[model samples]
Target: MTDAPVLPSHAYVPGHTARHTEGAFDPIRASVREGMSSKELARTEAFRAGLAFRASGHFWEAHEVLEPVWMACPPNSEPRAFVQAIIQLANAQLKLRMGKPRAATRLCQIALAHLDEVRGEVVLGCDVAALRVEVLALSTSSELQYNA
Candidate 1:
């Protein structure tokens, strides 16, 4: 339902850790689980690992790893938003490296949208203001410079 295409709950999303169960686990619940520390599965470690990968500039690698988390996130949940933002961020970075500035800018915008719902500056890059600035600059530059 989001503007972003909903990728099929693939039988095997490359970087996922859990089985793709439909309507089973919720992202907000999972995020709370990670925070509470009393849940059966400690997801904080897993999330931290993914963040580390993203920070290290391994966008594609981050995509591969964080996807399951995104898929697992239920609608209207922080986990869903967080994973969505991370995935969008990684995809944008990948597109940038591929020289597709338009695609990159759009993806960055998607990330910003997700960031708007819920975020931590230390965790999500100090909010979406910076991302908005970057994406707008790229989009404007691309639009003005390339009209072919």
Candidate 2:
């Protein structure tokens, strides 16, 4: 078979739409994903920043902070799935904050599905089981009081 073209590191990630192409091959994103694969997920500043934003009730910012790391991971990889789960969790919380319970519930379910692929394992320092418990509560509740 002919060899695949040697695209630059800046080439678009597979499955990303054109709108998601900005900085698609960031070096920092690659570094963070590499670190996470070696148990350094919690040590990465970007991951920690996303966690901080999530804990402080800034879900949209948390999603933005974590998205690059997720994007950096190879398709269908565990680290990618974990980061995607966390991003979905962040969006679920944002939906709740916006008073859209149905959308929040759907997002929470999607996040749980991603987390299940990891078999309740820790992701970026988050205890997946504990997070699942909280997310399940959020899914069922009509109101949320996050970190307030």
Candidate 3:
């Protein structure tokens, strides 16, 4: 998806009209930057804000917030992959909202690929294994409903 001209005050859901405007302040955009460890990144307000946005169905905002965390991690690192998986999941949800099941499924596949590199039960406050299962279901399910 293309970046919004400005951060919208309300969450965007495709096919549904919502008034969008500029001047919305985003903490992640204001403060998040590269050069942080996974652990440190997790502790940052920006990371928490990303999670909140994702949980609140603000998929685009979530992606915007989390991208910096992904970039901060070393290339090919588990932390980077994990963060990317989450971002992909958010994007997949956005695609689903846009009524593009094929695109959503494809995004889920990409998320799964990134998740495969992640180890352990948890990372950055998420259950990696559970997330993998959920993404797999989304990738294969006939009904493309995004349940958060």
Best by lDDT: 3
- Counted clashes in each candidate structure: 1, 0, 0
State the C-alpha lDDT per candidate.
0.55, 0.65, 0.77
What is the C-alpha lDDT profile of model 3 across 1-148, one tens digit per residue?
Answer: 1232333467877567563345243545555567877778877766777777887788877887787788787898888899899999999988987888878988998999999898867887778998888788878676664532
Question: After superposing candidate 2, which stretches have Cα over 4 Å from the reference?
Answer: 1-38, 144-148
What is the C-alpha RMSD, rounded to one decimal, of candidate 3? 6.0
Q: What shift in Å separates residue 139 of candidate 1 from its native position after superposition?
A: 7.4
Local accuracy of candidate 2 as per-residue lDDT tens digits, 1-75 = 112212222212223312234553343244365434525655565666666667677576567567767876668
lDDT of 1 by residue, 52-133 (tens): 5566665665566566555555667655676687778878766766666667778877887886876544332234456446
In candidate 1, how many Å is residue 10 off? Answer: 25
TM-score of candidate 1 against the unseen true structure:
0.54
What's the true lDDT of residue 68 in model 1? 56
Model 3 steric clash total: 0
